[model samples]
Structures are given as C-alpha cells and as structure tokens.
Target: MDTLSSTVQAWAGSAFAAVFRGIKVVRPQRPIHPKGIQLVGTMQRDDGERQPSGIPWLDTAGTNRVEARLSRSLGLPDAFPDILGLAVRFTEQDRLSDMLLATTGPTGIGRFVLRLRRDAAAAVFSSMMPYKSDTGPVLIAARTIESPGKLPVDPAAFRSLLGGESWTLELHHATPLGAWTRFGTLTLKLAKHAEDTAERFDPVLNPLPTAGTYGWTKRLREPSYAVARGRG
Candidate 1:
C-alpha cells in the first residue's frame, strides 16, 4: 500500500509539473509589512463600451469591494507577526469616489479621494503615518497613466489568479513571529447591471441560487405544482 501511494504521489507531482511548465507561478514578493497594503478593484467605462485594453468594467450599481492585511513585528524582534485583515466596499453613489483604500499597522485608514481623469493612468497606494491615529493617511505611493491589459479568458488561468493560492504562498514563506500582523487576500467579482422589466418598474435583483436549490427534483417539482395549481 505504501509503495502504491508513493507511486501515485510521484505521478501526480510529475503531471502537475508538466502541465505548469513554462507557466509563471504568481505570488506576492514581499512579506506584506504593516505599512504596506494591497488593493484590488474593478472599474467600468460609463458609456457601456469596453476599452480596447482588456480591463472589464465592474457593474456600477453593485458595490466595489477592497481588502488589505497589515502586520507588525513584536518583542521577538526579527520574526514576522500574524496578519490582521481589513475590508471595505463602496458603490458609485457613495461619497468615497476617487478614493484609495489604505492600511497601516493593522488598521484601515479612511480612503483618500483624488481627482482622476478619464482615459488617464492612475495608481493607488497605502502609506505609513508619521503620527498616531485610528486610521492614518495613505499617500500616493505611485501613479501612472491607465493602460489596461487584456482580460484572461482561459478558465484555468483565471481561476488560479482569483484563488487565494498566491497569498497563501507569501504567508508560508514569511517567518512567523509573536507580534500582531495583518494579512489577508482581497478578491473582486464584478456584478451584472440590473435590467428594467416589461412593467417599466425595476424588479428586485435576485441572488444567484445555490447549487442545492438546482437539483433536478426541485426544478421538476416546483414547475409541476405551479402548473397543477394554474399559477404558472
């Protein structure tokens, strides 16, 4: 049994290596300091047109969410502390437009709003505070003209990028310590816009049904009852 198990493990590893050969393994390069924060957000063009560059627009009606993890070393000096995670979501109508999410030392400072021109490039970053506050100021760490890239259509690549695997790799490489640290993976899923119904009134957006609700029995039973009751 042991020999069989080892052989299977070896075969699986070899298969994975072959499949992923020449594919770059994406992972965070830094230990995600308490002063450093990662930001991920989706933006859409207002005209309902997608730019030639590959960036997809997030639905305007749904809230855009952001997350960050911050951490600091403790008395044990050189070791890295456990990470604390923070997150926030804002919609287009929210007062916090043009804002950059910031994290400093296990805390989330309020977002800083900036002027951004359409078709222009921009970068948002979190900065450390010189003074103490519940939430500190995050300055512009870097900026550039917005040149979007093409969206990945491949299911495997897309899934790998969206999964938390990259973040997990970075955490594992970091030296564990006693101090409090911030660490978390941020994710963004774009929502589709709501449509107006035939009555000219907007219908409440229905949440996506769960897999359990999609059983064949449930689908068949519900329709049969409606038909029998003359309610279809």
Candidate 2:
C-alpha cells in the first residue's frame, strides 16, 4: 500500500490495540478463541517441485514435530456455525515458528474472507493474511483431508475426532493471486494430552524461516497479541 493509506491503518490498529491492552489488564484472558484443545502432530514439507513457492525452507523437504490447537473463534455453542481455527507451532533449527489459520472460502478473493462452519471437515482454513518473501507475498492454507465429517464443539467430543481416524490438513502456499502449491502436510492423531492447555502462539513474533511480516501486518496484529501474552 501507499504511504498515506498505510499510515492510517497503522494508527487505527495501534489505537485499538491500546484499548485491548487496557481491557486485558483488568481480566487477562484471551478475548477470542478462549477455549481450545492442544494437539500433538507432525508437519512435513515436500519438495514442491511443480510450483516452487520461492521460499527456501518451504521448497525443501523436511519434517518436524509440531504442536497445534483447534478452536472456535467465538467459543460458541456446539450447535452454532462459528468460525474455526487451527494454530500450528514448530521450530526451524533454533527459531520457533507459528502459522495460524481460520475458516475461509477456497478461491481467489475468498481466501481472504473468513467463513463459519458447523463441521470441522467442512472448513478450509486460510492464513487470512500473507507473509512476505523475497519473491512476493505468500499465503498459507490448510484443509482436512481425512474427512472427519461433523466435528464437535464440546471438549470431550472434539478430542474424540482424533483417535478413531487420522486428522490431516494439506498445507499449501500461494501468492496473493497465484495458484496454490502443495508444500507440506500436517497430520494430527490421538496422543496422550491434557484437555486444556496454557500454550500460546504469535505468528508475528515467531515467523517461519524465509517468511516475515510487513510493517502494516505487524501493526495490525502486534497489539492484540501483546495483550494475549499478558504484556502491554
């Protein structure tokens, strides 16, 4: 964006963030997606030879142990079609990395729009924003490949979705208006774990190798995330 528009966006976001920070000081809890389950899984990146993403780490092939979370954006009731979330955390050598996705349509412009879904299997999660690379901007996306069908909103039922079958999301990356290229896969299955978790994620703070945030992107997200971390 140009300087004028960018400046305005930054100013607006920072102001909102300051307000959120104040509120969080009073009652420190995640203002959104407060309820979620921690998941253990593996994330493997492919060679991506067909359509190279131009991101060095993403174009290479490797696998890493990952921790993830699945939650409703509003933490709404089980019967409602609330926007769902998938947050993945991993490490690249020494740097901790995170990528958070939300339910959105699977298309050109639709990829940037969040949608509501009653079934986890029915939702396609998008990063909702792009990460900057040397080539251009890239967006990451994930979708359930195992078709778990109706995912439960209740804690007990949501945990059950993992054990009986494989829960997998195909990981992909693309430019703002480019074709998506499959670069990896995230498979989350049943493993011994607690029902509630205190782990937190911040993509802006712990971005993947070869991917970083733009000034506007950081301005938009940094505030609320600081509040989430119990920081001002």
**Local distance difference test, candidate 1:** 0.25
Clash total of candidate 2? 0
- Top model number, TM-score: 2
Q: Give the TM-score of candidate 1.
A: 0.19
Candidate 2: TM-score?
Answer: 0.91
- Single out the weakest 10-residue window by summed lDDT for candidate 2: 22-31
lDDT of 2 by residue, 1-232 (tens): 5988888877877787887766565546776777887778899988635677667888889999988888887767777878888888888888899889999988889998889887777688899788888788888898878746666655678777655566888998889878888888998865465776677888978987887678888878887787778665
Poorest lDDT segment (10 consecutive residues) of candidate 1: 195-204
Model 1 agreement with the true structure over 1-232: per-residue lDDT tens digits: 8667656655654544433332212211211221222334433223333212111122111333432221221112222222222222334433332222232222233222222211111222232212111232112222222223321222233233434322211000011112212222223332223111111000011111110112222332333223222333
Whole-model lDDT, model 2: 0.80
